[model samples]
Target: MDRKEQKSIIEGLLFVSGDEGIYPEQIAKVLEIEGNEVINILEEMQKECEGAHRGLQIVQYAKVYRFATKKEHASYYQKLIDIPTAASLSQAALETLAIVAYRQPITRTEMEEIRGVKTDKALQTLVSHLLIKEMGRAEGPGRPILYGTTKEFLDTFGLKTLDDLPALSEENEQMNEADLFFGSLQEISK
Candidate 1:
């Protein structure tokens, strides 16, 4: 494809790669371009992201490229996170949090599998809100991050412990898992 198209594809690939990042060689393979070309394009994209108007920047860590927030705007980001709101939890965030609560130390992939959709954004939201945290890395290839509910999560839900969460019955298994999880939280919200 053309240079512009290549850059756009690279951006999407990097975004989809999430926190794992992507290697230049992988980008090259996917775009059917040379590694040197990928590096050049990445460098250009990195520069563009560094512009004052851009809130994101491309970061290279150990040869893996990924998008990250501009450190210069840390205060603004902190402010955004620190602001308290009466907004209820999003459906996706609630579902993801429920999965994490019921299934502590679960991998993102497993959560996505259970939800039948990607959970990256939901996971990020939960993490930013301090409702969930990265417990550790799971054992196996790639060593994906394992997530679990935080103390704040218990406090927010007014639960003394995870055991205090409503039990999921086998009959409920026939219903959508998200609905089951959401229903329990709705009661607490009232």
Candidate 2:
């Protein structure tokens, strides 16, 4: 591929890699290009993002390349986070929260398994909104974080306690766990 196409592909790779970032060698392998060429392209992309108009910058941590917000925009980003809104939970975030509400001390991997999609962004949203907090670490490999609902979640939903949550219908054995959780959430909201 051409230089411009390579840059675009690399940018996409970095975006999809998220917090895990991407190694230059991995990018080289994927694009079928030389490692040195990948580095040169990454450096060029990094420089391009350094422009004043760009809100994101390419950062390399421990040889892993990823896109991160510019440090100079921290105040603006903080303001955005601090600002309150009447926005309701997104479907993904709401579903993730419901799963956590019923399944306390759940790990992100477990949530993803239930939802059949990646839960990282939704988990981050719930954590940022203070609806869920890391309860502890699960016992096993990686010691994955266990998430549970916070007090704010209870107050927001106007529940006295976890027991206040509606019980799933035993008659609907065909209903998946996520659907059952969503049903309970709807009943709670009403």
Candidate 3:
């Protein structure tokens, strides 16, 4: 409705978007406003976040907007990180990890196609757990990030190396990749 309302809505969108973040064009499309106006509002909001010394701040990276904790709170956050916690992986995260493990350099879009749903939260969890990482960027448009399993994956799975992974039967290999991914997830969850 008004500039304040627009800025507040944009903040909420960025907060909910998490690490994936949102683009100005996406905000403009949703708000039915000009892209230039969205850009100007976002810039002003960014300044307000910085000047206010609020615990939360807006970050723009790769043209994506996200809400993040201020850098000044890093020490406190690090203290919390140092605490021990046993976090269990969600089924979706396990499935995404399995796909990344077998596919070895898959993109998020490809993973989503296999999962038949958006995999952003699962992907972020895998990344946070250090089971999957950005191996590189793809060759095509936007150069989407390519994900791959890491050494932590090997250690967590108690495998000596990727070669230690069980081989799929010829018939199974021919089955849908999503099935293979789910099969792997079941095996690991055991």
Candidate 4:
């Protein structure tokens, strides 16, 4: 396949495959090309993602070639996404994030059960914003990654640690007061 066509196929397969880190063979099958050809195209793509030309990184250490924001360029994404600050969460994201914070090492399926909605978007947003991360795989059938808040989560909220999060109760306040919410911009926002 042509380079343009191969690049298109790679992006589609990677995005659709989610964080699962799809294999080159899987991408090759989708593109109807020899697996070696897929590998070659991926090599070219990886080079393009390197150094000064990069806003994207083609990562592979986790056993898949998924596109990701280059670490140095991360400060620009809040602008590109048109959010007022570094990142903003939907209410659903906040709710699920709360659950994950209080009950960490939690699975997506378990979070879904608590929130009663498919958490794909919220989880994606949370992960993209670096508020939560994949702790590790569960010991269940799917072996899904457990989710938990990160050090950035603590810093963003001006907390010394996760234990600094405010107490919760049986009451559900519409506008809860907690360390979780902060001013729209902070230390790295400039």
The 0-to-1 C-alpha lDDT of every candidate, in the order given, reads 0.90, 0.90, 0.86, 0.77
TM-score of 4: 0.46
Cα lDDT tens digits, model 1, 1-190, are 7889999999999999999999999999999989999999999999888789998899999999999998889999999899998766788888888889888889999999888999999998999999999999999999999999999998988889988887889888667666776687788778
lDDT of 2 by residue, 1-190 (tens): 7999999999999999999999999999999999999999999999999999999999999999999999999999999999998766888998898889977889999999888999999988889999999999999999999999999998987888989876766785546655676677687677
For model 1 the local lDDT of residue 30 reads 99
Once model 2 is optimally superposed onto the true structure by TM-score, how far is the C-alpha of residue 126 displaced, in angstroms?
A: 0.5
Q: Order the numbered candidates by lDDT, best leading.
A: 1, 2, 3, 4
What lDDT score is found at residue 47 in candidate 3?
Answer: 86
For candidate 3, the per-residue lDDT at 86 reads 75
Best lDDT among the predictions, by candidate number: 1
Model 4: per-residue Cα lDDT over 36-97, one tens digit each: 98888888888877979767777786557787778887778767777657457888887777
Model 1 misplacement above 4 A: 1-87, 188-190
Q: Residue 45 lDDT in model 2?
A: 94
Q: Rank the candidates by TM-score, best first.
A: 1, 2, 3, 4
Model 3 / residue 25 / CA error / Å: 58
Q: Over the full model, what C-alpha lDDT does candidate 4 score relative to the true structure? A: 0.77
Q: What lDDT score goes with residue 82 in model 3? A: 100
